[model samples]
Target: MTLSTTDSVATAGTAASEQPRPEYPRPDLDRSARWLNLNGTWHFEAEDADSTITVPFAWETTASGVNRAWLERGVYRRELSVPMEWEGSRVVLCFGAVHHRAVVRIDGSLVGEHTGGYESFEFDVTDFVVPGILSELTVEVEAPADKRAIPHGKQRSIPRDDYDGVSFTPTSGIWQTVWLEARGRTYARAVALRGDSLTGFDVVVEAAGDTPADAVVVARVLGTGETVELRTDPTGRAAGRIEIDAPRLWSPADPHLYRVEVTVGEGESADTVIVTSGLRSIQARGEQLFLNGERLYLRGVLDQGYWPETGLTAPDADALRHDIALARDLGYTLVRKHLKYEEPIWLHEADRTGMLVWAEPACPSRFSAEAAAAFEAQLPALVERDGNHPSIVIWGLYNEEWGLDWDIPGSDARARAAEHAYETMRALDDTRPIVENSGWSHVRTDLVDWHYYEPDLAEWKRAVAAMAEGTQDEFPVRLGPDFVVDKSYYASDAFPRSGVPILNSEYGEGFTSLERAWHLRWETQELRRHDRFAGYVYTEFADVEHEAAGLLTADRRAKEWGGLVPADVNADTVIVVDLIPLRAGADILPPAEPFPLVAHVSHHGTSPATVRLHAAWLRAGAPADGQAAVAARAQPQSSTPRIAVNPFELSAGLELTVPAAPLGGRLMVWATDEEGDLVARTFIDAAEVEEPNRRGARSDG
Candidate 1:
């Protein structure tokens, strides 16, 4: 089932294959004069045929112009011309990412080899390149279909029932930007900056080649104009601290960024690297996650970072920005980048747009000594690469024990591995919190995270109550027990009863949009009820291959089942309703009995306001013309007495009754502000009539 690139209205203007992703790949270290984009069409070869493909799009996706999986080894060939202006400087070939492993050759001479698929790699092709002549560049990629030890994330070798709901199609070969950069012989290898005690930033700069005796590191903060100068040691390492009188914090409301320039030398021979720094601190304090010492409510979504046209990569930078904007429009302050490390542009947009990110590492499917060693070896570099992003507040080590397949949740080895990963991340960078494993079997983690997918709202409420009251062991059943060991271990025994903040990282697997919205609203409300929970991340932002439980379709179209806009269902203050006399989607209602309804009005907004409740009935099987149908059938019912609501207050047990009416009609319930503006609304379809006792009891009981 291959979807065409034109199916998405978002990418209708241009053929993704013709001009896919032409933007500058790296925004943080961008140098217009020193870098060249290598993301257009490239010569490609598979076992069967030689072809051309869009450079960054995976071979299996539609935008690549070859909508077939490159399961076997493939080769990418392109001609590179070193800019005449870069004659004396070193030429570096950089690949944003290549699946599994890659061997690079320049002008038929082997240059370098890299093994990780998610991290960026570069090679110095200066020694082999003829200064003014075009050089032949070849990249041989080996992405073994059956290699379970490689960190393939959700990519499967073959389609299976297990992946039908959550996993996505496999992506192979280059799925990110390819570019060339020219640098002087002595350049700043890397720059790292972290917020220092919430008042300033600590900067570290490393020089690439042999340092001259007069080498000194100069750091300049762009906005506030603070400068710090430090002399490098013999090895070309320098560290300095820059203090700001009044630090501007980064948050979802305002993502202020300060640009920093790090220079490795002085005068005409100086090499400089640009960096964007955000002053912020993320800490887990007693049952809460704090950003800059203030408690934060993480309204987030599970972002798979997949697109219909481009598979693992966005069709272009605009597509990436669109997803982030959609998430924000849906009132999500955070996005959990599930299983995949997205392109740097996505993170940069997140930084600029005030969206917090929970960055995760791609995980392997099977566990082994080799896999563990490989994962550990890649940890430091990965952290170093992404740690500078201000939007990334959390680093997720493992997800649901993907590679730790050896009796996880019951084996000591699993615990040891998780702790080791946590410690490894801590050693590399301590700027953010680390989740040892996201879903279950947590050991030595900064946050207690879990995954639950209860489709039934009443049952979900009960389960959350059990967890909040420390009685989850009594009700043993859960949405997916395998993801977590048992309710007992998760609620009490997973970690010490310390003040660890709990998060329902994954949930709401509904088959329909209405079902998804209802489940999301109720689950979010339940999590809000328990202050111990930091927040919840809905199952997904958009549909992936075979995973239809998304607010948006695979083509980025909004589903009708979702409310008019993101805020209609995901507002900070919203009204929740429970039909006491009818169940969700209940088609049959007793003709003689008056139907009772209960409402819970939760106000998270500031100030007090009066809220009014309204109800109406419309004939069943009405036209499906969306808002027109909804508006036509909305016959106003008698309004309820105005009730004053306060911020962060819950008004429960508000009751109303619907007089018995003819069968075969829909029931609509809505709430309004004092000015009669709609706040939220819900509807139930009634298609038949039944005796009171003949109907199943409400699940809310």
Candidate 2:
């Protein structure tokens, strides 16, 4: 079923109305005294109508009480009284995010202007503010209708269509929190924390202003009582390393974080910022991706960061936390934040909740010298802002050749551009692996990835078999017509065959009930059977508008198929089946004909054991009707001994015949251990015959 536009956590009731996103905006570098939350009500003007709307929520969202599309431009005004305590400090006005371009003014004086909708920006408003009196603050936002030049991720001015299936309604005005912070002359502008295998952390602190030579940066590990002091150089920067004996590594199972306090000055001139750090490292060796020296497989989902009522912004902090918890409950170890830079709060939740993140930058549709310059300029600041977060492991640059029209693989221009972007990212931070452009046209990348959405199960099986056999020529046939066969860019022979690890980053048919669950299990097994495969990420975690392929509805409600799979398929004890009789797109069945049903079951549990296969047929009816039709038992199949890394398969075939009838029914198959414990179950439906035909004539006629 399709989700209503207004049905969401934000519109449910007053639960979120009382306090919406009241937490500190920046959790990575937080200072309560130096920060203020401007997320309540503000004077808003849209379409020449004066109204009051929520600050952080975009004007176009229902949460703003102005549930309408934004025009070319909008205005937001708010009056603020600067605290007397911040008299001698630098009062900076900060904006979490504003869609497109924003111009700021205080008391009718222009302060600063910024472009780009996803990153944070701030201006020092100390000169314009009266310490104890109210000051008028105005923000002008201009969101153009053009999608080619702007780096608007999945946002379209018009309704979504086939050409832009993933795009949603455009959001304008300030979509994130606006606040005022007071800091000393010399303060910590940013911090970078790197984790080493030897339980040591290399910390680099960047200060904003000139340093006092005597000023030393003090780093204190809050709970562990570990401290390190380093003196700043002539440039007001300090770098040092601190070792933690026997550190507790951070993983999806245990997301442990260490609190750090960084102080730049001493006595009354001191400025302190609290930071959070995690002890973890990610590395790619040969054909495998490892985390902290252990082989890791990323079972992830695609998160678009959209809300029914709030557009790109989440309704509140609780809403963000709920999405993370939901993904984790469905057996996902990671989430790829697709095509948008999310708020720091979302990454904070991922860090604490034990879910890894694959972060990507928003991209423009058309390429130009100006567009390339804008992307390059934002890369360093983006890395500096989100570098300390432990949850983000993979840094995805561009997606599916969004900006570069000539991003064909072998082209020198495409290769040069991709290499330049890669070098730019590596210069800023060399901690995570960079995927130059996910899905296609891989010039320089650490991991080779692909996006496939073939609905035919047989074709998908063949495609995976070709990958296992290293037969690249036969891949196009098994990949179906939807697969792009252009080898001009990939050069046919040079296309990802060895060295780097390969990932099927996106794949899902989005069917409902039994069909969807069957497809998921079958596709997952196909990838796992290939020895060189690193991992796979399903197409999505929840539905987004016209893209109804998500396992959950757009409002985050679980579908009927949610209960069909095990609690955690990543666990050791699991069974997956690939049934051959239930063909894709085959809804009708012929009765009175014998057919062979083959089931290929893969056992991933510990220890070898015997399992029993049972089959039953039931007429379509409610449970109370008790319309049982037939039952059978196949010979027991013995599975091989449990392997830690690879799954062992067991195949069995049975011949069965259905009685000629007009009634529709379901064929149910179950796999159980020797102790009668249910491992997995699947069903294939048989359509009802309208009328019996004899000699090419209907009986009713």
Candidate 3:
């Protein structure tokens, strides 16, 4: 889920059954029964003014119930009626989010406006509203036509440039829930939760409006099981701490959360706000990441957080929960929410279901003063709003130096900008690690991660091995107009690289689903076999338009990996086999002697995983007199007479003989766990497609 939030949408400010998103949106800040969902239907139109699009789904998407060209600017109008009983309270109109920018007005009069599409915003419309009567609420939204030079993230940088492979279909206008709430004149405007699993928790409440000078704030905390009376300061802020006698750590295995309720006063006139958070600590020491003092690997996937039918919005709230479940099923501990401010409910689900996340913001495509300001604007909202969740383990600022023109290494200003963003994020929340620029061009970053999409299997393995050996710094990773392909300067010439965990934040670029699966198995096995890399994130979890590197389709269906299982490849304990023919569809030619196949067990589990090691080598159906050279041989695949080794320790090496069948076919390789499960598998065509020497691989000596 991208940084998207939802609100219950039952009616146009009335409790009706026809709303699309009926769940109360702000699970992070619950004020009981004083809110009304405004998510059903709104007057929507672009420059042409011919359509009525849905509120939560973008105008271009099919789920929006409209079919038209997506325009940059759109307007939404609705008439809201507030219940007479809630007249004495302050009426606040809230929006889960709006794309790019949104301008609010009541009865054709300006109320307020908000910029930035990913975070939530609201306005207190107390004076403008007349209770029990309809009030005209109009929202004018503008998502700039120029996709670049703004924090647009994975959306296409050059508007309708179909050749742009990285960007997906861009969405515009209101794509999240809109609602209204009633609050007391004095209430908790913002609640900041901080602490860890070991010590305790801290609560900082910002009191707003006409809070009495003697108003008392009591927070009935659930996780710590204590009601601490917070001391109010002169600036209308109440701060307190809760100590836990028995603290339970939160992790992917056990995601325990703490419930918080902050009451502003004592009697019936008092107001309360509810929020949820968890306690967990993540650290990196000498090339390994630890959570709750236990070593853990970041088996993460890059998620674009989009759907085919719904451009950027989920059809329903359960889709948010399903994304987390899918990530877990793929054997990933963490999901790097790539480039999009995802759904807050997604973060909530991760908190409840025990999933780690590396959150990122939509990034501008080029560098400029305005772009930097817009890019920096998203940081505080992202950090302050989602900081309370324990599922977020890392904060990512720039991605591959997108807005910086991909020249952070050469340009001091760009490098400083990345470093400055890191400092800004640290100032906001110093609990988790921050990647200055994920993938490469790291001016300042906690993890020395890189992104590569090399399709060559041999080269990929070599790069992975070199990185694991801590020698990858030898290569320069600069990318820009002035960058020379032959340049020799390291990405970080001055910054020290020792002791930091090396990870591949982005990789996996194969041409087809079968090839992608092949790359997945080989690349993953190579990474695990070394056991030196701290972690890796596949290029993506699902395909988005032209970017076909996903292990799953855009609809979340698993892509065929030619019978290879993702869970087995991603398991903490795994078996990896080294093969000469790594490329899919490549054939294995029989040598005069048997070929050597070395397999190793890469286990990151707390305990050793000794599953029964088994292998099946399907020999080609060649004639019995196959002693002759198979340079131009062909054969049928024969699974019979399977080669089995008893208690075969790979340290002794396994020898595989190739016999070409009469017809051209494949020679399969299968690795099984002790429990007879299909832990690992792969295959290569056995015979050469043509006569070998006739199409000589090398000139005669």
Candidate 4:
């Protein structure tokens, strides 16, 4: 019997409510009509196992509300009565994503089965549908944490902490959206864009068919206010060379997307589909990344889609938008969504908000021949699904060499599998950059990636700077580390370059460590100069179980992971405008011993200015001594110009002159005049500049 419409997690299947409709299956095509969101309560039962849980979101996630063990085998059932209008057309069942193995049956009849958890697969269900009553649809899904040769990133067999080297909670189950789309026989299968700084753009339309060989194809470029149409040859394939004069390039700053709608056959016999895209080029020249023929710096952060209540499945479109918005607020223009794929709506919002995206496949723990083949097959579908989103410019194939650990005996097979996967992705879609491996190991691919953790900012900078000078042969590999500055490997002399643009694919792991674990307080960007260091991700977006490395708490509350803050400052609070004093053509200051370089600061506000010294900036790279002090030359809050001085004269030997400011507010002062503004100043004076102040931890004094 097919399971149908039940609210309980254990027995719910693919009911209408279980579909994620708001994701807008077609983002490139504009439609003002509303569709149903089928992502909630459905009837389910394990065909071979014992229990049923929520669909899409993993069984282990809090969103399922099950908190039970991962089900290896299960039968999911739901009911959907098609509208009478769709009588002649075929009914298609579309699964946004399913884990490992899946078999679908309609009206108690076997329909089809698909293998692979990360990519979406669909089948026609028109033959199995009844004319007027509610038809039953059952989907049997099997996901065994088997270790074979699949491109699993970091997923493990059981929910454990040892995920590669990351101590994060385990992930399992569907973990994505599921839905259905009813369409005509000859619909658009895949739409791709290939462009560059030289040739402009070439649109490739891949289609499915068994129709007559004389089918005509047409592609229309939908611009701001005009549409350019191009016709293709008789083989149901089309290509258009578009030369946009001074094209409005798509980047994090201005994401201008061009819409393209293709139609096959003449009016009465035509089938049309729309795909949205942006015309731009991204390539690496040595260690510099060029976007639209200019050196582009990627200011990004790691975004793991999770929620306190929803876990993997987003609560609504707002949740998805919130992630991009938060990243934007933290001065990040790009987001490297780690491991898991997001709902289409997430990419839609990213496109809308002009945020750059680095998309990665979900981390798979088990590997096998079936898994590899399944993975390879699903790549085109994945490209088809998110290709319209201009925000996604990079495709990451492997992360930190996690599941495809090259140390094993079958490592060559797995490595070949990963290479083939990335190669196939390129074959299917070559508009964006493809990362072979995210960290350390070289896979002889388009982009070389690496991971490192070093506390020595000076050393890291020097190494990267040397590479910028072309002392290294290969381009600079991207760096993804757990911490911004790792103390242990800080001064190590090992800096390897394999010829690629250097971007921080990962760093800044935890922002909430201040409250949970003090030792984990190295999640801030104290020494990161945006111009020199390029860009980096601030740990994570939310706290994932034991991994408290999030700029936001598990419940979506904001936390400070990097030094960057929101541009919109509270009118009532003192706004600390950080203005760096630098000389023309001056090199970065050499890192001194582990001591705090204190700057006596005083700000003008309605009342006394008080700042909370978060421990993030005080770890590792900070000075060892703690004797620095700020004093005023003129009275505090004075508009008159005067040099500020350090009370302890710590900056006496520094390049610039130091003066003291008159005192206005006490330590952690409370200001008056809620609306009034005050001018404040500070001075640094000390025999020696001590390390940044630390709370709870032992002091040098």
lDDT of 4 by residue, 86-173 (tens): 5554456667667667888877788998876667677767678754567777777777755234434444554432354453333455
Pairs with steric clashes in candidate 2: 409-489
Tens digits of per-residue lDDT, candidate 3, 1-701, equal 01112333243245444566667777777764787777766777678675566778877778777644447888887778877878677788888878878999988889999999887888888888988877788889888778677778766644543224567777777888887888777777778887664566788887765663556888877645677887567788887787766777777888888788888865766768887876778887887788888887888899989988887787777888999999888888889988887878888899999988989898888787788888888888777778888899888888877888767778888888888888888898878888888777666678777777667778777877776666765444434335433221135677666677778787775788877876877787777766557788887898887777788898888877664557766776655666645355443554434344455556576544344333333445321111211321233322212223322112223344444344444444444445644444444455544544565467668
- For model 1, residues 1-701, the per-residue Cα lDDT tens digits are 11112111111233244455656677766554567667767788887858887779888888888777745788888777766777767677888889879999886789999998888888877788866677777889988776477777888754232322356778889988887777666677677888736788898777765453447888988867899998777777788899987888877777988888877776665777788868899998887888887677678899898888789988778888899999988778889999888888899899998999999888776777777777777776677677788899989988877778724556777667778888998999887889988876666888877777665667777887777665652323242436433433242255675578777788774667866765665567677666556777888898888888788898788886523345545666665665322333453463456777777676655467778776666666442234623563366574577788765556755677765665656656667787876665555566553446856756875
Worst 10 residues of 1 by lDDT: 1-10
lDDT string, candidate 2, 485-533, tens digits: 5322132355566788778788777456445655676677677655577
- For model 3, the local distance difference test gives 0.71
Instruction: For each candidate in turn, give its C-alpha RMSD to the true structure in angstroms.
Output: 6.2, 6.9, 7.0, 10.0
Please report how far candidate 2 places residue 570 from its true position, in Å: 5.6
User: In model 4, which range of ten residues has the least summed lDDT?
Assistant: 647-656
**TM-score of each model, paired residue for residue:** 0.86, 0.83, 0.86, 0.71
Q: Which residue pairs come into collision in candidate 1?
A: none
lDDT (C-alpha) at residue 55 in model 2: 72
What is the overall TM-score of model 3 with all chains considered together? 0.86
Regions of model 3 farther than 4 Å from truth = 1-18, 157-163, 212-214, 474-490, 585-595, 609-612, 618-701
lDDT of each: 0.73, 0.70, 0.71, 0.51
- Model 1 gets an lDDT of 0.73
lDDT for position 335 in model 2: 91
